[model samples]
Target: MMLPSKTVLVFSLFLLLNGILPSTTVAAARTTIGFTYSAVPSNSPSPEHVVAALQSLNIPAVRLLNPSPTLIRAFSYSNISLLLTVPNHLVTSFADNRSSATLWLYNNVLPFHPRARISLISVGADVITAAGDSGSDPTTAIVTAMQNLHHALIDLGIRTVSVSTTFSFINVITTAFPPSSAEFQEPVNSLVIKPVLEFLEETNSSLLMNVYPYNVYKLHGEIPISFALFEEGPFNFRDDVVTGVRYHNLFDMMVDSVIAAMAVSGYENVPLILTETGWPSNDEHMNVEESKMYAERYLQGLISHLKSGLGTPLRKEGAAETYIYQLFDDENESNSRRNNSLISDGDTMQQHWGVMYNNLTMKYNIHFDNADQISTVLGLLVPSMYFLWLLYDFRLAGILLVLVYFHSRKSEGLDTKITFITCQIFTSRFISGLLIDIDDYFCAFGAAKTHVSRSAFLVSTMLIFSVA
Candidate 1:
């Protein structure tokens, strides 16, 4: 006995509901949190010290500026994940020969794979550095090097590894105001950006960027410090052009700027990870207590946004992973000169920024266990909700179709009914034709024939209506 078409469709829908829906729900129940650790320079602090501090804080992942032996050794026995970096100077050498990349990985990464927990490698630091800086336009070289490195890592049987590069201040899009009008500079897009975007998309690597809202506020003093710090104060100004998008915070605006840049570059789906974002407590430019307040507020605001599980204004469904800038203040680098680097001008203020200062004392304690639990719950709920939504939509469409059929049947004898039915069928055929044309165009661009055949069926339906 064969089942009717309607019965088969219902059964197919039931199978989708039971199998595909539940699987998608389960898959969506995971969340990732990561941090960047560039402050722990090669000789400044022991990797063991850093790892111990991170472990005490319950940090699960960290990004390193360079994968030094000390750092790797320190993280060897820990479950903390590492994202290692390839410095800018070595990029050109790797680009010269792909084999060199393989050798570099063998020496730097391969040996410590499982133990060190190095999950990702950034091929080079900031491709878009200040113009006229030493070897500023290394985008092509860096991207090629990254590709080669990725291939090498894959060949070495490192399945979890990824290759990509990070960007800096120069990469922030022009016209970043209003957040919607953001786009990369024309020169950077042509020279250093397009290829890197392609490579990142191909390799499935996050677009790591060092975002500092403090600098934006410092540079443009017109914007309120309260807004920059995500304090609960009224917006400084509301945009006249895009109503309702008030200038309340710099971080959201800056993120939207990156989102806009990605949209213009046609790589909108690429993940935007905040590789560095923090404030210095003792900078000459800002007050010490204010800096600490700003840092705390900025972090709290960012974590709240991530917990909300919504994308930015421009990209409402994008990745919201963020990594705070530094674990501790380094005495080596000249922090005062560079506006970006935050250092405690005095000893006491410096101690305030670190969760565990130089004396191994914990400061400003916030429970991570509660936050992690919330993240886990969201990880489960979001995917489950999405799958259920898909099932609901499918069921709703079926019910609507049934209602439309019965309504049409009841009104068949009326003249207005005949015209309405005719118009509905006509509109359906026109839409079907358009869909068929789109499918053919996609097929021409190398879409699979299986997909194209579905388009062909839509075309056939349109032809049958046209003849009738």
Candidate 2:
């Protein structure tokens, strides 16, 4: 592996140039992204403030593992879509008695529905393998609870509120190499996952999966850091030996591995909604810079990929939504029941996944929405240095070009109009275009159906100049 600092520097430069470039395709935007608000509310942000901040961020969706009265009140009458989760313990509660699902809705959904944008009710958060689950047959319990809830929602004419569950990627997926070769291991797949897939298929709801490339990369150092951070990883590009499908990043690999598992289970077509993914701002060692960059690149590259409509190799142009794992650091320990990480309890990293300090200070220096990401204080320094180097080289080249132009004008008496046009074509059109114009990147990467999209980016920027 390359030195991490050098790799990070190169990655930042890549983002800077990528952003500065003009694109023929509609520029990538924040299309399928949301926040998984911390399960138990944090000490700060008063539930009200959390909702208010979303409004200012121009974000219209948030997922809550457990509902809060204050959150309901704040979300009520607003345009924000809420994905409320049913706790694991309650899975058996509703399973023990199906009719109780109706009561569950009355208490949770009825109070905040069309008015508060309560769009989805995730059955439970990672109940299948959650450490403390008491249910012997989690699959049966979770399915029964979902069926009951679905019936109750349909009876109440709330067809929009879909039902599903959130699952983590650790200890569940046995192998995820080459994506097409991926599959789930025994018991977990047969006992729980298969039935859940059938239920979600019947209900036409997307599966909620938690994928943390940070954890995968941290634990398995074999994976490149760039791949973990969502940067274009040359080392990660691989073609599946079995199915011949290519995968680029660990994020897509993890997601498609579940899709592969589904195919192995005799179920092949179920969409996924990423319910949790975020990097901590610090760990026991307080590595804030590395932590913040991890958050920055991972989120930025994901936003671009989704906005590009380039789904995983399995579904090239499909849809997927990713909710950042957490909104605030759980300083009060509201949702630390499962630390999933191998770190000791003393390591604050498990709880410090917020993109900022609870006080709203930019911990990752992150920007939400369509704004250019990766302009963070740390990210900007590398590009600023690279720009100076480029300026020096560019000045040297400009002097030579000027010397030739003036020599020609004085000695050869070149036609003034011809000289000016020649200069404009070279300096204004081709060179500038070379610096920041990408046409049909999909074809550039050499994917299938290249001819179909090859020329769509042909509208040379001459059109922009003429119109302006």
Candidate 3:
């Protein structure tokens, strides 16, 4: 059954507009997706091999958990940005002494800086957990350490590497149920996060966080598993009663919780970076939730959602950069080092969080690039072009050109003249069709009232009849 021409035209216009508007209107900066590489000295692959793998995967950025000069040097000229981290154990020492920060930078950063593309320096990862393990409060020392590091970079004339510390979402956010009602936990909020945020704002650095939807789901069983997994369905949503904003996924809620907390702290404009986020493919106890399938689903969904350029509900720009947990599972490392700072919900089970094996092979089939953006462009463009071809019937134009060329070929020295005549003919047909189509469309709406002027209609009809 053939649809009405007007209906077909409206459908074509809908597809064209839907396809063109998304690509053009939403000009938000693309969120960069990267991986975290934590090296275990005994069993890890060579830095060169890792760099090669990252380049092959088209990974634009990487966060080094235990950054070595060798590993830093491997990324020199690789064109990949490095987010180098300082061990949590050294936070207090660096905070107490400025020389210590400078010396650390000399060993890790100075030799292969711009070449290595060292973008951000994470002063420490989850210092709260480390401080508790050490039986003291070194959380405040984190800001001091960051300040010292920033000064050290300045002293060395290195201003490109921004300084900040990483915080675990579970450790900081007081309430995760309603994101808008969330706020940073006590003492630390005032003593640590607020001060750190101020320093970050001053230096124009982003707040680093390790947010895991798995942890949130585990802690709060009432929340559906699909929400944490980034599954989209009509019922897969939660309403924030206070703010009246609906949340589709748990990750966005967790992120917006942080954003809301920051707004409360008076540094809402500061950028955010996810230093660690991923699901474990396996657990020591063989738990149902911790499997390869769930892991793949979570990572794939997270990547696609971020690449959509639709940031979290609170922050339109979303995370500036998000690094997937670990590249290779470090089986050789002790359980303490493995789950060092990511302890959440009183569950510190040794989990396999690596996307790749120690043999440097990926466990899951994943595309690290934003191929979805390319697919979106092609998806919209192909249909739009098809609709355009249908609307204009360019097949006739092609046939006309062929006939004109063949007929003119018989007459010597009429090539240019025939080409000009063919263009004129095509232009007249296009204009006549356009004007008549407009008149017909409006006539359909007005029941025989023509929108195009009568004189213009006469001219177009005369040209069409003459051509025929």
By lDDT, the best candidate is 3
Ranking by lDDT: 3, 2, 1
Error of 3 at 165 (Å): 0.6
Candidate 1 regions exceeding 4 Å error are 1-31, 39-45, 135-139, 236-248, 283-290, 318-320, 335-355, 365-468
Poorest 10 consecutive residues by lDDT, candidate 2: 436-445
Q: TM-score: which is higher, 1 or 3?
A: 3
Candidate 1 per-residue C-alpha lDDT over 28-70 given as tens digits, one digit per residue, 9 for 90 to 100:
1112455566554444466677688788877788888767765
Candidate topping TM-score: 3
- Which pairs of residues collide in candidate 3? none
lDDT of 3 by residue, 1-468 (tens): 222443343335334433432211113446889999977747778899999988988899999988999889999999999999999888889989999999999999999988999999998878886677679987668888999999999999998999999888878889887999999999888888899999999999999988888877877778878889999876789999989989999999989999999999999999999988998765535578888888989998898888877898898989999999879876654443334333443333456778987677889876656556665675566546444643644566566568766767676653554455455556555454455444544442334545454466457545533543
Q: Which sections of candidate 3 miss by over 4 Å?
A: 1-24, 283-285, 332-348, 373-468
TM-score of 3: 0.74
Query: Cα lDDT for residue 312, model 2?
Result: 75
Screening candidate 2 with a backbone cut-off below 3 angstroms (N, C-alpha, C), the clashing residue pairs are none
Local distance difference test, each candidate: 0.62, 0.65, 0.78
Candidate 2 Cα misplacement greater than 4 A, ranges: 1-31, 39-42, 131-137, 233-236, 283-290, 332-339, 342-351, 370-468
As a whole number from 0 to 100, the lDDT of residue 356 in candidate 3 is 87
Residue lDDT tens for model 2, 177-275:
756766776777777777788888998988887777766776676777777666775586656788777667777787788787778778778877888
